[model samples]
Target: MKLKRTMAILMAGVTCAGALAGCGGSGSKDTGSAASNSGGLTELTFVMASRDEFMSSIEEAMVAEAEPLGYKIVSQDAQNDSSKQIQYIETAVNGGAEAVICLPVDADGTQSLIDAVGEKNLVFVNRPPTNYSELAADNVTYVGSNEDTSGYYQGEYLANYFKQKGQKEVKYLMIQGTLGQVSTTKRSEGVIKALKDNGINPVEASAPVVADYDRPTAQEMIQPLLTSGKEFDCIIANNDAMALGAIEACKDAGVEINFPIVGIDCTADGAKAVQDGDMAMTVFQNPVGQGKGAVIAADNMINGKKLGTGMEELGALDTSGKDYSDSIFWIPFEPVTKDNVADYM
Candidate 1:
């Protein structure tokens, strides 16, 4: 496959410089061959949607895992542009990459990416496409925790807290991530479903604010709500960053945080907040596990190994009892509270 890709590029008179020039403003860091490195080292291109605290951790883990296995990783930042992501994948494929690991900018718009990589192994990380059925090829797979599970954990924690308090109904302020992403929608829906399943009536204290998974944006958006004299029993953020932002907003407004505040992605800050008695709980979405799993999946595919091969290190794979288990690798999410925050830290 590598030889054929190389010959195709050469015969088409396509140089690395020309391909990269077409990538236009997309930030990239190449640690392997520029465009012509077809040496003994296998090349894998990692195209990220954007860089954030959790995403950076995943990227670092991928780099660490790849180095010891003699795989060269070319990391690129798509800056949340679908077109840029497609360009990066094309450039990587034309540059003789054995596999393309991408965190799609727009999960719903991944058909273009699948078409771009053609026969090369493509591993979609962190965010899976909206349509799971679209990933029909054996060469394509998804590696990430179930977003619904993460939110379910959050809702379960909150439900237990309220139930122990003997409260039947709770009003919550929700800080959502990017509006259209599968993570945002599923996380939001899952939390609601869990709350209902737990026999808790949930009410929206205020209209949910979209923060785009940004901390400062979450803080700014929630500040007015804090001072608006509205009654909310708790705050629920799609991710830890936004949860921390809500905490900041509460502090800035001199509001006492007597209610539970929960979030997903037991990030360092979120765990610290849980320990400090600020955040009631958080769900741990293992970035390191996801990253390593993605790299291993790519290596397995390239070597003609079955999917999920060598992924036992990530614990038992959650096949969801589906026939397509081979194409989806699920990393479990753990609920982190004061009792178990130390374990995650």
Candidate 2:
């Protein structure tokens, strides 16, 4: 989809839920801000794109971490709609949010919304900017795993694993998310480049199925691909949800081929599947730290403490060229198979 740049793409609104549910008492809890700090209760709004279990867990952990430091958390779920995500951001901006943490649904389109909101009230999660140089102008400080590196590592590991197993040509299929988004674009490029470097020509499917990052839609998309009379040895899923969907599709189609499924995002179910020999490997994205980091940095900024600047202000902040030391922070990636599943778990 062509991302719009005009004002028509900007938005901010709330859905049916006043606040997102499903945050149990499993996160880090504090009695209250040490009781000695002078900062009063700070109100923060988090605008997330969807309701994945991993995202929710991170949200809860963030809430727990923030509450102890005298901060209240208000979250808005955009349901993976770019317009709605922008709208939620607008709402946060208008509502006088001290700071906003967002997981952008449409990576490119939200650049304008971030620009409109200004720097005093913006932080990003999961998705970072393609042009990090412009992040500060739009008021975004992004915190997430490196998509390209993660995908490249997954591809390299899978290829080497198959190579050692006496496989000559490895046929690969990609179940991608929305087109042109930073994550999807980088992940696809990384995977393809890795396969090509290893002398493998991956088969390109006719169309990339976009499930809007939903599991049910991914399941629907995979059922057809699994039975399309095409033989694929490796399935490179953009996320674990899609990986699981493809696995389900394989089971339903009764295909006994020993296909290795690789995915990003180390959720519990994905890890469990790896343990059970269903999935080959996955990248462990540190979702839990997303909210917490944003809040900490925003709080530091508010508290007059110096924070690491983004790529936009690197020269101004760090003349020694250390600001951009590693903009793309990665958690870790474990090549989880039946052998290492127990260790990872």
User: What's the TM-score of each model vs. the native?
Assistant: 0.88, 0.76
Tens digits of per-residue lDDT, candidate 2, 1-345, equal 111100010011111111212012111111122112235656777888787797796688578768876787778888877788777777766666656787777676667657656545466777876665444332345556557577786778777877888775677777886677887788778877887788666666445677655567777887887788876677888888888888888888897748788887767888898887888888766555555566664554445333332212211122222122222222233345566556445
For 85-146, candidate 1 gives per-residue lDDT tens digits of 99999988887776899999988898889999987778999899887765556567788877
Q: What is the C-alpha local distance difference test score of each model? A: 0.79, 0.62
Off by more than 4 A, model 2: 1-40, 205-209, 309-335
Which runs in model 1 stand beyond 4 Å of their true positions? 1-40
